[model samples]
Target chain A: MFSNRRSDDVAAPRAGRPRSETARRAILDAAADLALAETCVPTIDAVAARAGVSRTTIYKWWPSSAAVLAEALLDRFHESIEFDDALPVRQALTGQVDALVRLLRQTPAGALLRQLLAAAASDERVARALLAQWMDPRRESAAHHVARGVAQGDLRADVDVELVVDALFAPVYHRLVWGHAPLDADLATRVCDLVWPGIAATEP
Target chain B: MFSNRRSDDVAAPRAGRPRSETARRAILDAAADLALAETCVPTIDAVAARAGVSRTTIYKWWPSSAAVLAEALLDRFHESIEFDDALPVRQALTGQVDALVRLLRQTPAGALLRQLLAAAASDERVARALLAQWMDPRRESAAHHVARGVAQGDLRADVDVELVVDALFAPVYHRLVWGHAPLDADLATRVCDLVWPGIAATEP
Candidate 1:
């Protein structure tokens, strides 16, 4: 999940000073922008130019454009997910879906993630970094809530946790990747409705 | 969606003689290979060299590397789907899923489609061509069979056909793009099982 190495490598100062948060933010934003704008992964030099930082800064901090992108993604979108166990299973999952739908549709995050997806299809490093830094954490969190649904006796205990979670979110992603339709709360409600019955616990 | 223009452009040769089917096949195969092997969309010249065809042949027939990539996609993986209306709805839909699973898991089609997906994400032309030639046709065909399921009263009469079909196949694609699991028959079975109950009508 590249989580461990990222901390050590990114914070190490080649300039005998800690890396500037402002400069790092600028670089990550530029990298995400360039990738979306160009419809391809941005180069380190290109990101530096856009960020108004020297090429040395980018090289000193991040290993590759993908590395910057992964970090950029974390900065822009990570830690925004909330899983309230107090709520019923459907509302808990629906809350996550609504939040994600907003992140993707209402901000630059969607364009940026689409660009990352494009990059991941072709580049192994990008794919690995993205899976570890972005997707796995979110998927794990979603699975956590869904697993709780089973343990709470709300969802079918015999349900496949991964499959159930995937069912909940796959329709949204299907639209996102294919540009087939809008990612809306309505779609989320409909998916929850369709999937809930299949996974809901059956009483004897 | 992109169905109209693709027919006009790809078939018409700017040159006096019609484009050779043999040459087009080579070009397409080479372009798809380059995208997967090089881990990016191949250049026109690279495709020309790989295909052992003249650069002019490629230029005369196609607009860009993405165009060639799109055409390559259509040529490589089109016309493999089956959606029989005669069989029971479950079996018929399962057959399509089974065929797609095989194409994705057992052949170069999966690699080719993944490469096209990457190209489509970044390149608008690739995206249009992919949707028009590859995705739309398959979706429409699948819709045809699904509608039959509705008409035959196997599926719920009130079902939203688009949403139902999306539910059926989105998980397969989610796994494809994410590489979380193998594209196999068991996944197909689970998806159908989860989805069928939601979409299936109660027996009278």
Candidate 2:
């Protein structure tokens, strides 16, 4: 599930009427739309015009255009993938990885993510926004699930949770960025199967 | 070890004097220097000027500035890390990964690589150059090593060579680009240890 923490709420207290959920949704939607339609990150003015909100309104909510785009990306990811708690830890991990690989391969969000990553390399603001808005939240969710799996004896208690999370997910992004290999449908299953023996608890 | 295949040699046969090795080396060195010194990919003209070679000479040797930079990166990587054939498979892999982490963390090559990756995302030429000149060679080297391990009975014969290579190296690059965690001294050892159980041949 996505967090409800909006940048505007955390920036400073506002004396005006309660923040408009409608406006916030419109801004994010517009940002995502513009980012997908163009080769570059959408500008603040472009987003504001597309959303029919004043630039001041966008500025009030997000610190930068990259922040707005990051939120839009995070929103799309949340909509596309949901972790099923009822599944076994291994199955759940495989399913999550499979869904992510598919999202990156079969959607506009994939292109959007590539664009953000490219921009983040040069722009510190973009990098910070991506980390705070997108990568951190996703990593935290995975880490928590991994920790639970460890406690339940599905995974080894000695597992390094952060490294395990990286081992599970990093290859997907690596392929996505490097283009050295295919991000084929079975990649998730293959990756999980390869790392499973190292992370799984041994039978008594 | 780096391959000796030059892009110029593959493009077409040259009719004149043998290609100048001195010029080639100078061009690659200049390209690497400029890329590290600047935030953006240096232009062909800038590289030529820096190396004291004409634009035509650079063009004759490399199809694009990115190609030149890719070769430069490949050169630096070869200089920084060498795989010792005498070591056990696991130790060699661990050493290779650790050396790469150090190279990325402790050298200028790291910044140059980040710049190239950022540029590659937008420019098809850069992407192709990076894959052909840098990523493929690196992956090929790792693949050969893993295949050797399997042949030697040090690794599971059923292991996916490409995926195993990815597992060992991708996390380092992932952290490099994402900055989600530190590429510390022990990262390579930890990564190799985590994946070793899955990769190593089970004891009879």
Candidate 3:
């Protein structure tokens, strides 16, 4: 669903029939569903079969299965994460953590994330995409929100925003990859409580 | 090699011809070599073939390939990590970090770690083994050293041991998995400086 159907920077719109948005969505959905169901990654053939599209069509754009799945995951994240400034900084950070925990518990997206992490461990392209599109960008956005908290004197201005971001998010990643525990609301709350004081440190 | 090659438990009189320790060492060396190649994780079949051992010989003990590799990694570490109390706590912590960074830079060990991490992300068995054998053991060992420092008034009593361990370790891991940059002496010093103060914090 996230694969760009059309190329950017074209001189003008092509006269040919536009790509079918419905087909695109089906491909992504099928990829997500297949990822959750399978042991190893879902092959492009499996995705194409599930989506009722030719393998050629799937491969026409995405360079690899990881790329397709990465886009699908991004789509899921974009739909789920809503930035609301009205909530207090603490409230907002807490909510983001909760939301992230909840989303990770979803079998398909969680499995996909694990797959991408493994793929990224070895593949440079997947690594760059993950860092740029999902990991760092998300952290930067969270830091921006946390900066507002610092401005309001709700958090320590001296807090290393990047470190604070890592403190909050890296644990989730670490747990998901290593801890073998479900990232539930209780765990999220504990993390926030443990980290909030340090992150919100202020001059006496 | 650490696999059940005639239990050391049985009295020598009862045991049949003892397994050749040299052959065991050779098998481990070959496994590490193949893993460093990294096109695919070396399977028991491949390791056996490379080592000129029977498949039954490998499976007679290790339930999984990860088990074999895990033992090999541990064996490598055993040769390197000295478990004595001769070194001062602060010096030990610093030296241990340096040793770990150096170990991760090894061609075969590095590849094996990456493979194990990928395996850990997907397989619960691999994840548990890697944690028990490598990660948790080291952290626990490090925590004890840190506790001794606190007792001696060389570290902060309130410093969260787990947090300190994670902070000290995670950046090195992040570098290992993400960046190609060498973990230089300067970076090691910075890590010590950044972490030692917090751990050494007094009521100032």
Candidate 4:
């Protein structure tokens, strides 16, 4: 489940008004832009300046630049996943996997993820945000989908959804993060094939 | 094929004899140490300080810190791959796989590999050296073992060595890089089983 880190005190506020949504959007956009352009860790000052806002203003909502970027990227991912209601589970899963791969392969969001990971090696706050906001939820969603397949007897009940998601998806991400090789359609199919046999039910 | 960057240098005679092996060893050791203990990507100055030598001395041999670290780490990996005289192909291949997995799971070398990958994302020099010195050689050795399996009639000659290796081993590497899951013995065997069906001769 997603965390409600965003404040909910606006209902009975004694304040003049709620925070401007436009300002929040600008700060998030600026944070993502800095991360994309630098392909390295972005600083609070850099993001604030790019957004034409004060550092205090930027920090009021998001705890750090990584948090801002993570939320922004997650928002985009959520939007993409919203349109999968029309597809069958298998097709939906395949499309979702492909989208995740393409996102990591073709954009600054991928770079930001790696940058966050590198920073998380030394920064506890960055590490927590990465796990809570990105990896854990993504893992949960993939597990939910796989668990449904098991319920329907499309997949083996013994299949560990968590491990399957990692095995099925990590190679593309590994290549993306490590810059080892390209993750093409062939490679994606190889990944799905390697995992499908174990996931699929073989006998009654 | 390997890049010609390092090997293409002309063997020019100098007024004095070449750099001492002792100094070279010290420099290389220092480079690896600094990279592991301090910053993942240690500067030349840091390496020199660790070695108890001058930056000029390091610069006299290697062009960059990446080059220095690459040679050091590459030397360690080369020393790690053992070649037993009369081992069967399966035993040999499994030994090599186990050794590589052990290195990734249980050694400082694994951390160093991840460090190099982080640097590789931002530095092309580091990327090229890592591919040449580490990734390529390991892949070649893996293919060689598979080829031996085919010769011994344990494996189908028609199976693509590279794809089989990638299918069996890439998930392990992917797990290491992504930190999504730990690489365990059960997973390793599962990967081997998944790939072996396609690579081994069909049942009579």
Give all candidates' CA lDDT scores: 0.75, 0.82, 0.65, 0.67
What ordering of candidates by DockQ runs from best to worst? 2, 1, 4, 3
lDDT of 4 at A178: 54
Q: Write the per-residue lDDT of candidate 3 for residues A37-118, one digit (tens) a residue.
A: 6734578888899999888877765666776676666655763445677878877777776777877776556666777878
Q: Compute the lDDT of residue B178 as modeled in candidate 4.
A: 54
Query: Measured by TM-score, how close is model 3 to the native structure?
Result: 0.72
Interface RMSD, one decimal, each candidate: 1.1, 0.8, 4.1, 2.8
After superposition, the stretches of candidate 2 with alpha carbons farther than 4 Å from their true spots are A5-19, A37-40, B1-19, B37-40
lDDT, candidate 1, A1-204, per-residue tens: 223443553455456344476787789889767765664567888899899999887876766788687777765565455566687878979777777787777766776677777778877877777776667667777888888988988888889888887888888887888776668657877888888878888885
| Per-residue lDDT over A64-126 for candidate 2, one digit per residue giving the tens place of the 0 to 100 score | 888899888777667434576677778777887888898888877666777788888878888
DockQ for each candidate?
0.58, 0.79, 0.26, 0.29
- Tens digit per residue, CA lDDT, model 2, B1-204: 445554443454455335566787789889888877764568999999999999998997678898888888777667444576677888878887887898888777666777788888888888898888777777766777788899999999999998999999999999998889999899999999889998899887
Best by DockQ: 2
Q: In candidate 1, which residue pairs clash?
A: none
Candidate 3 C-alpha lDDT tens digits along B94-183: 776677777776546755676788888778878877776666656776777778788877887777676666655665665556442345
Better of 2 and 3 by lDDT: 2
TM (chain A) per model: 0.75, 0.90, 0.77, 0.80
Better of 1 and 3 by TM-score: 1
> Which candidate leads in lDDT?
2
Q: Candidate 1's chain A scores what TM-score?
A: 0.75
Tens-digit lDDT string for candidate 4 (A1-204): 333433341122345344466666677677766677777567889888888889997776667877777766665566434324345556656666777777776777787787776666556676666776677666666676777778878877777676667666666676666565676766666566545665677777
